[model samples]
Target: MRSDLCSLLGIEKPIFSAPMGGAAGPDLVASVCNAGAYGVIPLWGKPVDQVAAGIDQIRALTDRRFAVNLNLSFAYEDALEACIQAGVHGVSLFWGMEPSAIARAKAGGLVVMSSVGSVAEGQAAEAAGADIIIAQGWEAGGHVWGQVSTMALVPAMVDAVGVPVVAAGGIADGRGMAAAFMLGASGVWIGTRFLASREATIHPDYLTHVLGASEAQTEWYHDLYDVAWPNAPHRALSNSTARAWRDAGAAPPGQRPNEHEIIGTRPGGDPVVRYQSYTPLPGTTGDVEAMSLWAGQGVALVREVQGAAEIVDEIFDEAMTCLAGGPGKPGPN
Candidate 1:
């Protein structure tokens, strides 16, 4: 079962814990890597010092391979420097792609993984020196890259790129992992499924909402004119806030609740409510409703909040069983 991806990342399993940015903590990341799966810490919008500190913390916890995610749209330079200085195992860049940044990361002897939306984007990333290219389909949580689904995107990128292809979006279980591998993906990156885990630092209420949500409960808000996310599509739970916006004919940006206001509480013992101001929600403080509840359609499959190590072990075990035949069943002799 060893592919180029497993060899390159030095992981026994082809699963990689996605960099959930503010939600992914050192314990969670370290735990995943310790479980023989790779873990990534999202470094979007954080100060270089903070990023360095976080990386240091993970390093102190585990000697296993791990990655630091760079949101290219923000202050990527500082983030890149932090990764280099901290001696991170690898770097994953999402959103916009920068060839020079990729070169710099690779020059520092760090493995580089880039996320793209389309086959063309995957090719470009490979050309730009990406060691691994993740094809993120529209069904993915957080910010989706392209309008295509994982089924279509995975094979396309595999054909177009020379580097290892990692499939993302709506993949949670071993069944999905087997499908991705069948489609030519060297590995898979999981986000939403891990988000519901006990290691995830999200608010309990938020986790509850995801666990209780049905497949139909999730909606693509980026399709609405009022909720565009630059080049990415976002899949989220349709809540009162989203419905109100849709019902109000998608009010102008200034008129709506600011992200910070929606997820943040006011001073003086005010109840926690959605931000009504213009500022975005501060990074990863667990204001469930205020911040974007980025999740995948696969959320319906998540039933409980288990430890990260337990969850990783279960996913790998289930995937191996499924690949053989079905759970607890043997493959063809």
Candidate 2:
């Protein structure tokens, strides 16, 4: 399991906690880093000062290295500048891999990483000076990158790009980690599993939803939960809001019923309209069931809410045990 990625990032394990927007907090990020795995903070939709403040808070908690990811699907030039000024150890760009931003991230003495949907995109990012590539399969939670499966995507990206490749999408447990290693990935990126961690402030009900959900219940669509951000494809559990639209012929965002209706309020007490990009955070009181429950096909494997340290160690140990057994053994997917 000792790879160049670990040496480059100064982490003990090849696991990375995906910078899930609106789900990951400073505590979870620091906890992942402290647990001998790399932690990435999601800098999407945040202002410069707020981004710097988050970096400072995480730095206060752990001296180990971590990375910050920006969703280039949205606006983020200022967020990159703030991360550079804050001296973040790394920067990962997702959605549309803006070449200039990756170059700037590299120029600022930060390890530049990119999340790509295809082998060509991975090659482009490497050509643009990215230090690593995250191959996001469609089975991943939240906004997915492409339609490929992890088994196929990871190997292709690894072969296409000169830099190290990290496998994401539909990966939640040690079996998945071992499977990723067999696929020739340098590491794995996990999201839904960590959302169940104690440090993450996700709503209790949301965690319950993930714990109880089957792979069949998770569906993918574009503009289904469009409010703050529109026309973007994502994976989420189909709730009342999503079902209502589906029953009505899956109308476009503008034609949906109760469009812009205030359905809930977050922990901050701000009114969140229906289909807006608001997760059921702690202290949120409203229709938590109807909020977009982003999860992956691998979510059915997530069984308990453990600390980040425990989760990392358990997964890594299991992966090693599985590898020690023999080659071509199917990991716990």
- Report the number of the highest-lDDT candidate: 2
Tens digit of lDDT per residue, candidate 2, span 1-333? Answer: 789999999999999999888788789989999989999989779888899888999999999999998988788888998988888899889989688888889999999989998998998899999999999999998888788988899998887888999999998988899989888899999998898898887888888998898888888887777777776788987788888888888888788888888888888789888888666787888889888888988888888999998989888988888788743336586
Clashes of each: 7, 1
Among all windows of 10 consecutive residues in model 2, the one with the lowest summed lDDT is 324-333
For residues 115-225, could you state the per-residue lDDT of candidate 1 as single tens digits?
999988887778878899989988887767678999999998898888999999988888888888889999999998998777787766677788888877777765322
CA lDDT for candidate 2 = 0.87
Candidate 1 lowest-lDDT run of ten: 275-284
Mark the regions of model 2 whose C-alpha exceeds 4 Å error after superposition.
326-333
In order of appearance, the predictions have TM-scores of 0.88, 0.96
Give the runs in model 1 whose Cα sits over 4 Å from its true position.
223-232, 255-263, 266-291, 327-333
